[model samples]
Target: MPAGDSWLFEMKYDGYRAQAAIAGDQVRLYSRGGHDWTRQFGFVAPALATITKGTALIDGEICAIDQHGRSNFSLLKTSLDGRSPIVFFAFDLLEQNGEDVARLPQAERKARLEALLTDLPADSPVIYSQHVAGNGQQVFDAMKAGGFEGVIAKAPAARYYGGDRSTAWLKIKAVQRQEFVVIGWRPPEYGVDNVRGLFLATYEDGQLVFRGAVGTGFTDKMRREVHEVLQLILADGPLDVKGMPRAEARACRWVEPRLLAEVEYTEVTPDGLIRHPSFKGLREDKPARDVHLEVQDA
Candidate 1:
């Protein structure tokens, strides 16, 4: 369905997807994969506790904001390990008073989530993720102009899908960058020299899928550094990612899918290859198995 009066749009922050659950004096924070990262993002639980009294499950993103107020992806680890500025932007209320309200409509759930954080102190680590209902095109235009990542649109009447990706919740990006598992790398060639290109893949519907290669955007120094790491992780084959191009597969020197990289692209071709993809950097913090592609409808 097209975005309009029936949809809710919010800024899609670039950060760690997390869920914070608070019950009385106890609080816990979990990654999207269920890892307990409370020690890492230590400020989330306490701040959530100060405002939310009853047992509640809140869905949000833990992010570091820059001088321009945009979420900074590269600083996420710094926020966890150093004294960087960070905040947990809560956008949905999944449970309350020991009751699961995940099946509630999006608007109602968000309304309750806002009420739960109405009194959160400015210094608190938890901040409410604000949104505008409808007018999504306007938001997208603004995000593109401001160099913001994208806007997410959620069906106002849709139910939350726990630990699952759903089409009801969609993201429209101003920039196209995705994390890929580095299964292999081509040795430095080009008249210049370093690592040449990277063979990439991602998880889709819980299955590993080949996403083809990215050869551009690497500086000589970056190639040298990553080539060094690739030497240590060499393997006999790429993970069982299906649909790899025959020629690419024949040429690949496989490595373990233990590395992740961020890639900027123009679009995904119909056959699933990245169009004009360029390397952004290594995503040392993200796990290979957790990297997934956003499936676009035909």
Candidate 2:
């Protein structure tokens, strides 16, 4: 590949997408789909306001880094709840001084964002997302070697599209894992000893849609424990299944949508089902409404 001024790269943090918006003295922090999370985050919006003189909107992620200095999702909620240190990795400046900067080139926007956050306390939660020019393959290889999630590639000239995925900003992951709602289950096979597996789904537009079954990565003890929980929430049938391909649908028992699960998958199928999905564990910190899916590019 030819080296040029067109490409930029950033770290792919495994955390919650957050947007900090400030108007006058009022500030707000939002989760994906515009969910208000300001009160929970505590000081994110206010800190950003202190740096910028006027109204501003900052797009970023709320992450808790492990001892290795890499973002770790498993520690995010607990770290936040305990009022421990967290990092607000601000990547994009959407607006400043009531002026929209979404149309600005990526490099120009990042430069301005860097200048806005020139001085911050060493331990401040708010951090300006840093990027490197070119050397994507080398950086990605280093990420894999360092056991990092992945790296993101961006078109320096591309304009920002808030809350939307675009080719201009591409992400490639070395590991695949995310939270999903356990909507149902499949009982043990006629002669099988333990429960078969659980039916998992993710929300799209706040609507729960079936993803697939996760039967692997569970210990015998966990299988039995999860089975007991599903039994308690057993329901007549899937509550709001819009559709499912007959071939993919098997003998499964539908349960209420309450339990959340963290799953690891090799990829997301064309039909939006998770491929090679393995049950990591229960996601006690995440709510069912926050479950979602993203199919990686082939």
Best by lDDT: 1
Q: What pairs collide in candidate 2?
A: none
Candidate 1 residue lDDT tens string, 167-271: 778878788877898888776545444578999988877786888789998777778888888888989665576888777777777888878888889888888
Using TM-score as the measure, which candidate wins?
1
The Cα local distance difference test for each model comes to: 0.80, 0.77
Clashes of each: 0, 0
Candidate 2 lDDT over residue span 182-206, tens digit each: 8777777676545678788888888
The TM-score values for the models, in the order shown, are: 0.83, 0.76
Q: What is the C-alpha RMSD of each candidate to the true structure, in Å?
A: 3.5, 4.9
TM-score of 2: 0.76
